[model samples]
Target: MLRRSGLQALQALLELARHGQQWSSVSAIATAQELPAPMLEQLLLQLRRAELVESRRGRQGGYRLSRAPEAIPVAEVLDAVGAPLQLSEGPAEGSDGRAETQVLQSMGQRLQNAIERELKQLTLQELLFDLESWKEYLSNEGGLMLG
Candidate 1:
């Protein structure tokens, strides 16, 4: 499972993607996403280190995606945020639990494979577009505020 922090980081990046080529400040992103500034700062730093985003300094300084949203895979964001798709092994066991371990391992591998495959196919641009469409639909249909 992806960590909560990873999900938060993904949300922050999605927020940045919504801005296109423009730079976005941590405060603005956090405020918009209802996330803590400190958490977003750390996530941005991690993403920068991963070369997913670049940071600027000074009064008008902020962060922007290093590459186009369409080029960045969702898996890359998860990787940048340290959300690994693999599973960890449990304690060593004797022959009694060998079959159970094998079964669990197979299931875990299948799950990870499916998740990675889907995530690799997803891009921030597509995700943002879908979200915008959904928000529009909801607002028109039910008068809900998604922003």
Candidate 2:
């Protein structure tokens, strides 16, 4: 599961991409996505630092994707927002401490690797293309609750 901030960051970028090359203000994105403006602004800052989005200043100031959405991978967005696949830390203190821990760690590693591989293959463009399904699911199922 992604943290709330991570989801917001992704949404913010999606909004930017949806506009093509046009800049989207933080307020516009926040309103469109129903996310908090301040928080979205913060998330955009992180994305800017990661070079995923570029900002303009002055009256028409806002943000636009730094490059084409197809060039930005899902993993890059997640990494930019510090949302990586999470895994169990391992058993507390069971029968086989070292062995059990190793097994758990191994399993976590495999899962993480698989997730990373999949994410690498998915780009913001693909994600945006599938946005309609996501919105429908979210509306029908009350959406995913980000931590």
Q: Which is the leading candidate under TM-score?
A: 1
Tens-place lDDT digits, model 1, residues 1-147: 678877887788888888887889999999999999998899999999999999999788899899988998988998888886656654444435678877776777787788889899988888787778777867747644343
C-alpha root-mean-square deviation, each candidate: 3.5, 5.2
Candidate 2, pairs of clashing residues: none
Cα lDDT of all candidates, in order?
0.84, 0.84
Q: Score residue 21 of candidate 1 by CA lDDT.
A: 75
Instruction: Report the lDDT of model 2 for residue 118.
Output: 90
Following a full C-alpha superposition, what root-mean-square deviation does model 2 have from the true structure?
A: 5.2
TM-scores for every candidate against the unseen true structure = 0.82, 0.81
Model 2 Cα lDDT, one tens digit per residue, 7-83: 78888988898899998888899999999998888889999999999999877889999999999998888899898
Clashes of 1: 0
